[model samples]
Target: MCKAKNMIIENIDELTSRGNKKGRRIVLELVEETLNQVNYYNIVKEVTKLTNDILKIKDLELDLNGFKNVYVIGGGKNSSSMTRALEEVLDGRIAGGVVVEKEGYTTQTKHLLIVHGGHPIPSSDSVKAAEEVLRVLNKVGKDDLLLVCVSGGWTALTSKPPRGISLEDHIAMHRLLMNSGMTVEQMNIVRNHLSQLGRGKVPMFAKGATTIGLIAVDEVEGKPWGPTVPDSSKFSDAVRVLVDFDLLDKVPESIRKYLETAPPSEESPTPLDYMNNCLKVHNLVIADNIRLCESAQKIASKMGINAFVLSTSLRGEAKHVGAVVASIANEIANFNRPFRRPCLLIFGGETTVTIVGRSGEGGRNQELALSAAQYISEGSRIVIASIATDGTDGPTDIAGAIVDGTLVPRARRLGINVTQEQNEHNSSFVFKQTGDAVYARNTGTNLMDLILVYVE
Candidate 1:
């Protein structure tokens, strides 16, 4: 059984009145339960068990004892926990390997060398860590077995710029793309082309080895750029994304040139190329946002609430989505149209924020929650909580924010203009002043973001 931590809403009682405090408490309890189900330690244990059980089937079994070398390599927010689980399962049979994780999330490993890297943006440490991963891959022989563990933050944690591209170029390109409001898929399409290890490039270094990838998927569609799996995206697709994002001219000259000039044949290995190499690789998605949503649904049912999963692939501008959700909740509260009173609506997926101008500290989840606050009708007993599963929503320490119908009125009383904060991309500051932010130190897991709405 998964052990859950307490809900992290600091001013929980203050966010509501005596009339709806019970509803707020129930919502917080549901959130806490859902988060526990996606905890890294619990995920690792569950995936490890599932992997072992699947391997027990005769058709899926591999003789690890026959391999000359058995190694593990990959990185992300959950990489450290995944490595620890692998170490426990494989024991002394594993050879030394490398794994990278976000700073401050590293776990103690006996054989795997843990590298601390940056997230949201790649840094010099990310470059060094990628190089070390490549070195480990080079040592694998034809008969070796390589276990690759990939999770949410792998893109930035394992970032390695291609030759002639400096780390600054990579960072600038990433910042531009992030601020440009491109979807994660679009950004990764361009990113896979510029990096050394993305787009199935990791298997290219394995030569004649057999690679098995255990992935913790953050994206809703189970599309995570496939760092170890065969990549279906083409260089042309990458170029198209750059143009679509209007980043063709804004990005660094090196990045633009690299994407424009690089021939498809010369680009990183595609799905077809992986078949020709003497390497065999398998990619398995052991967890995703769907699983998180399912767990939430079950917990809500247990609480006797009519829980409905609105969408697992929710995506759009954060603030707009927040209002959309509020509109739905308003409809339900006004007429009980969508189910009935005392219901829960759940959604899981990532949202984007287009940084129009100078921005302040805030993440998509925080902004979304704040924006949703406005659309909720006054005196309507509805509460919304939006949170990043990784615990760190953006660059800030807070996971996300929670708001009720009374939030706007409270902010008005405090002379805080919610709309002005939303316009300035300063939702975090507004949330801080209102004591509406949900705080969680890195949960060491990422399955995109989770939004929960409770209508009373």
Candidate 2:
């Protein structure tokens, strides 16, 4: 479904002066197409296809005779559409439940209850949705099933603060926490600690319910929601996050100055396994960065470029990783230790931006792309591109950047403001001036970002 492909570089004129529009538009279209290629629906379809063998569809496997029914429940940006697919597949078997997602989270049938919540920042409406989810879960029985559709935004969107710490404080802490560079798991530990409704607490509201977890792992690695299916996150780990962020004082005074009190983080009690009977929590990874790398590989092979997929779960600071990837490609070209010249190396992962500077477009992909571009300019014979699959990088609309050897000279000649751009943390601007920014409606699903370094 993603048809945006590469065009041969016939001449430099296409990206020079006024004629550069075509080059810019081509790059943008590529980004758009890739974004479209990664939508939740598309990702869900891919996930279902890959996991078809695992989904127990037939009631024949076990005794469904006395099982009252199955239902849907969850909250996130992608929860509704994904849950709808589940409802469509299960039909009458899915009796319906509460699903809280973005504002337009509507089910095709009137039987299901859809709740709208805020994103990035959870609003009062999200709190109401949380209450509604709890209310719905009260009706569950031993044989009932919980079909929870969870995506990246669940930690903030699906939860509400306890009796004391208000949502305002919760959000403030969350922003501080995310910008702090702690892993999502570490972040969630604190989050679950502050909230009354987290850990395995979601299904506890539903007595004897078996959970089917549909998840999108953005920051954490491997099994998403490990804390849910009876695995643990721990309360002390939450406090350590606060300490790590140097915000031990910022957490609400009632949050029990966890810094002054808890034992060593090594000896902390993680999220309790509250479920009486639990399912491994069937999680079919509907979407991830690996798909992007595979797609990039296909594109590269078609273009007669030797391709490689580095890693799907690559993590760390964007600039550091960018430099490392660029260095590797340089080594491959100069020494051919891994692969020879004219190779296309691709990587997929969620990279973090340590934004020490203020007033910047903080997308990690762009920052990394810029760093790679700088390396290419220094004689790597490389053309570089990196895009966030969600069509958004940090807070910018541009997916990422693309660059080549000529980028530096072009910027120097055209007064393209290189240092200023990087200083401002505007990867979008630097790539835009050189006709390299990718723009899409909504191509890639999840948080998969693509980094393509071309040597030829």
Q: Pick the candidate with the highest TM-score.
A: 1
- Compose the digit string of candidate 1's lDDT tens values, residues 196-224: 88868888888778888888888656664
lDDT of each: 0.81, 0.62
Q: Name the lDDT value of residue 430 in candidate 2.
A: 72
TM-score for candidate 1, residues paired by index: 0.93
Give lDDT tens digits, candidate 2, residues 73-187: 7666556656666655564566768877654334343457777766656678768877887787787777876767766666566667766666777777767766766666676
Q: Mark the 10 consecutive residues where model 1 has the least summed lDDT.
A: 50-59
lDDT for model 2, on a 0 to 1 scale? 0.62
Candidate 2 runs further than 4 Å off:
1-66, 102-113, 252-286, 302-304, 333-337, 378-381, 408-416, 432-435
Off by over 4 Å in 1: 1-20, 49-59
Which 10-residue window in model 2 sums to the lowest lDDT? Answer: 7-16
Residue 395 lDDT in candidate 2: 59
**Residue-level lDDT for 128 in candidate 1:** 87
TM, every model: 0.93, 0.79
Model 2 shows how many backbone clashes?
A: 10
